[model samples]
Target: MHPTTTLLPLPAEAPPSLTQILDEVTTVLCHILPSSLSVKSFSTRWQVLRSKLATLKSSISEVSDSLHWSESPLLQTLLPNILSTLHRVQTLCDQCSDPTFNPGKLLMQSDLDMATGWLSNQIHDLDLLLRSGVLRQTNAIVLSQPVPGSGKEDLGFFIKDLFTRLQIGGIEFKKKAMESLLQLLSDDEKSANLVAKEGNVGYLVQLLDLNSHPSLREQAVSAVSILASASDQSRKFVFEEGGLGPLLRTIESGSTGLKEKAAMAVEAITTDPDNAWAISAYGGVPILIELCRSGSTTAQSRAVGAITNVSKVEDIRTALVEEGAIPVLVQLLNSGTASTQEKAANCISILASSGEFFRALITQQDKGLQRLLQLLHESSSSDTLEHVLRAIYSLSASESISRVLSSSTTFIIRISEIIKQGSIISQHISASLLSNLSISDGNKRAVSGCMGSLVKLMESAKPDGIQEVAANALVSMLAVRSSRKELVRDEKSVMRLIQMLDPKNELVSKKFPVAVVSAVMAGGSQGCRKRLVAAGAYGVLQRLTEMEVAGAKKALQRLSGNRLKSILSRTWRA
Candidate 1:
């Protein structure tokens, strides 16, 4: 009996090794090339198919050496399908090589086209496997084994493993991987550094593709948002990978939650000016404007923040203004939550600072000034108040806005209260604004009511700049005779102006104080000039005159002439 030739089936529990599968694939390709070459009519089609198979084979060989082929989840998932495709090619090749096989030409052509497409897909799969950083598994393995006495577990392995899933896993797997990755990034900035170091930020950017599932894109954007917000290095990498274009698309088309995360990412990445301009070039301003106009509060806040950052670029600020962002921002100032209102206020301030055109736009917006003033009354956060004050201050720089502001007596009184009671920074801005407003001849009387507040601010403000601003504002107000008379009537206010002229009193500008005193002397009664001279104005003006401070020489001459006249009058009376 021929040694009993009963063939035993291989164990179902054990799959073929990677090396065995690769060998089988190579053998099948070798058979396909010779067999395909023999079919004369379809030789060109066969050549194309064979070339694709050969490329797939080469990709597999290249990655197999660097990757631990046995342990690779990529190969484990892809190899079975890859091997099944090779078998189909092998059967197709055999049919083409068979002399007796007579499948119609159309059938043969279809078979060849199908085989070529299959090989192309397999090649792409292999490409993804190699790009997935499967070779980095060596680092993961070494990192997985704990070092002696190192209490902290290294997450190198976990991060790399997640990247592999993002790069090569199916949609469900990628979604899960992104969720875990975001959680990891949210929990520790170290993971973001690792992800950046691993050069896998592009993987997250890839998931932002418009063709990606909405849930996956949202998760991916969330991950990117965390990474960008956490590290500048990762943010640079994200921008390099063209993250802004996709992020803008997400803002325009994605769901509210996705748009919010994308806007946050855009805001964080755009901290760099290059990224800011890049966003504008990609037409991000209008999308962000629309989001601020219609998105949820969180989305509106983030979009406004992004606009704020982008508008730091001069041209981009022009673009934002042209896109009608000012009115939308003004609308938010009235309707958004406090945080949103603050963001809107800040963006408007930035726009206002950019140019006179933006300031005019802000002023021209419906109820823009009204909404900002309302915020000052309603917002309890110092940050919000600061931003609103800054926006108003910026608007106040425009002559038209200044005239409008000066016309409102209620506005003038409220500003006086703010100068007295607001934060020091708010006080400083308010004082500066008051100075600007006082320049308008028509505004002088309306703003003159704030003179007491300005005098108190000059004496009590901490920063020298604030005091200087108040003194300067007092000088502007003094341009009106009514303001000078009020100052002379309040002897203490005249005394404060005298104190400011002292060279030793360095907190206020000498020119401003000199101007204030000159106006007060010129407008006051002779008794008022006598009181000023008694209050030490003569010595302060004399020193300032020697120091060559502007307006000082004339001021001292004025005071001396007044004193000489007063002495002559006394003699004449005696």
Candidate 2:
């Protein structure tokens, strides 16, 4: 049998003598105090001392209550003094553990000397009383057994002992051992690392198995949650030890508290990509979706967070959508907290990225587009807006959705405003959305009203992709007769299009500009043609005609009869 599982024999039913009790108290105090000289050890030393003191106080009370006080006056008198000394020592330990206490300054040699001297006086008085036969001697109370080993070695032994008890001990013993291990894992990252490195993580994982006691399984779930949350390395260790299978099982069938903690553990573990696939294989996606839909607030948040992480991969994202994650995430977006709303938006973004089928699924949900637009309007966070815009961009890929969004004056204005003022990514997405919306004639005219902003975006020194999208939006708008007239009326707009005809520009950069010029010349309005010519369109087109670029040849062919062209031809010949 494991030593930790071996319950020590209980003491006989007799009141202890004063001398024996004092000796027992002294031994407890000795273990509580630090033997090392470093002041850094003070906090740990105080914690151990405080725990031992509680057990000693309980034992002393038990012995005192059993005595016949009137028949033992000396014992009674000395008991009060001894108890008083214990109380003082307990108070001192409490102060040392207080957050505000600076160990570096408070743990001076002089302070230690004073405290030890006082304790010695109390012990000496108790001994003198014993010699005078004023207090009877009884068997010493063995309050508790001291853990074997010291310092770092002690932590290793303590973990091994707990594991042994967990394996072979009774229900009550297992509970106590599990609780002890849980407390150590909860203390800090260092403690959790110690537990993981000691090969106890696998044992803890075993406790979570189906065959383990329900209560032990619950405690084990809670411990795994702590270890997984304490550090990334510890979380990886739990996953490697096969934590995901039991954790998902608990989420599916455990009690409410266990389910909540198990969900949290699964969430932490799923941060690793391999574990995410394992969770999905264990059929965790459907369970997570249910948790998001109906679990407690904490469970719902963690469930959604896990789904968000899991949905990052393509195959899993398709599975999540098929399980109807889109509508549930849309519901969460409308009613959940800001954080939940953000995560839901991210999941939706990923799902929507899968393809047009998933995009249509999200768009077809009741108030799905409305909720996403509302979130876009209400959110001040850049990340949330970025995801919302990405989803919008995907949804806009469907011409039906694009036409719906394009027809809404409010939606068009909001997207145009984002292009004008949002973050760089937001600007890029908004531009892409506008480009998609511009595919429809009515949407073209609607976006054409914001021509100045589009022009500025194209002119800014952002990446070619952003500028290309903006240019495409402008070119699409130019296809509408009214928008074409608007472009020709603004000389700077006309001049910008003319400048884009520069031969050195990339083929992509030149495509829209060529299309815009061709559209204007095709309008055949003499006044618009004269405005383009005045905006230096003649020189740009003459050069393009020489190079025989696609749309430039067609545009130059149409300008053949201009009397103004003759004057420009003489200047070009020079």
Candidate 3:
């Protein structure tokens, strides 16, 4: 007859004392006699089981020293499973030692294999908890004052508990923890700083792995986005922790919602210009371009924004072009939403500013000029128009594109209209665009109608660059006799130009104003010369000439010669 044996009860719902349970398991494993078993296979299995228990004990001991291990929420939550598995090992060893309860070699070997596997898993879970550094963080954290209306709950302890839950639990537990953490981050910037300061950004970055659940990746990316957007320090933490690659991967392969969040995170991180090359290094340009090409509207919007930031790097801008971003970006100029089109326009503008080669890529290969002009006419949003005009301004530097723009009476007239009536920014960029257009002789006549608007902008002269650009445009258009006639005919235009030449008017550049005065003196009607002297031009010109301003001496010579001739002709008539 077999001796009756008592089995250990299942672990209770609540965690048991960690030190007591670990020591008890250690003693039980140490006292086991694998060599006493009759079957060699059973003895071998027992030996393996003992080896796994030793490893588990070593890992526990290594981590237990870092914190109040018995009270650690992570270790405490792990206790029930740890005890369950250890008790199973004990029961199996007891059965192996029992003479009357042999279940045969195969069943015993299978049972031993299952126990070993379970013990290995428990060890893995423990290692994951230890590696999380949550225990050390918890031990060192100083508890803050209770959050208002939370009934004196220790906010620091609660946050650490959430971190523990994230690291040491099943998918559902981690999901809840992620949800709660995200909720906390969303509440305020302070919470985001606290979470990021704990050095757990890598945990969130891990969730961005392609194998993770979609919803989990989405949550992780959303949390990362918040942290990156919170401040420059958190963004540095995200980059240092290797978050960019996974984020780019998510943009490449995640669902629409997930891609938007990931794109947003990428955008925020890349806002630090130093981080821009990492996107290119990770081959994110193609992914972002593809997203701009085919993602959902919101996804496309975010992808375009990220590209805008990433493209700030010179090499990434070339990579973007090499990835065929030009066509895709041009196509986005017609996107149904204003925000998407606006971002696409901003990105295209940036690309166009790179060099003439990129401008050709946007204008020649993709008809970007036409699309921007079309957007110019169709869009009512001032912000969208501002970017679109800026893009057109960028493309206007190309001669072929300039001809196309100058020939379009609608485009020229639109530039005129924007200068006259658009927002201050739109008007500024439009003035610059007109200045660029006026560079080509053929476009000079086309842009001559904008002379009044240009003169008005120069008269405002609040933002000095716009006034300078308008003055340069008038200088170019003065090559056309009629543009010269138009400028000198407007007394306000003549007065503004002379006023800009004053050394006291230091806000506007003297170079363009000097050029304008020289052009007007060289080409204007003699009556216009009289108006220059009348608008306080002689004093400003003499002072500028003394200062050795370029073109100032020639303008002074012309003004002096004209005045001397006028006096001689008057004296001869007398």
On lDDT, the leading prediction is: 1
Instruction: Work out the TM-score per prediction.
Output: 0.78, 0.57, 0.75
Tens digits of per-residue lDDT, candidate 3, 502-574, equal 8988667787778777887776367767778888888998999899988889988877786788799999999
Ranking by lDDT: 1, 3, 2
Candidate 3, residue 32: lDDT: 47
**Clash count, candidate 3:** 0
> Rank by TM-score, descending?
1, 3, 2
1 against 3, candidate with superior TM-score: 1
Q: Give the Å error, residue 564, model 2.
A: 5.0
Q: What are the per-residue Cα lDDT tens digits for candidate 1 across 1-574? A: 6798889998688767777887777777677666677766687887798788778868767866774656665566677777898888788777877889999999889888987887787788677556655554655422132343323334655666677677667777677777777776766666677777764788789889889887887788888888788788888888888888988898988887888888889989988887788876788888988998888889888888888888788877778777888788899897998888898898888888777877877877788889988888888888988899888888888887777777776676667667777888887887887776744555676657667767777766476687778877777777777666666778767777777778998767677777777766675457657777888888888888889999999888777886688799999999
Residue 127, candidate 2: Cα error in Å is: 43
lDDT of 3: 0.76
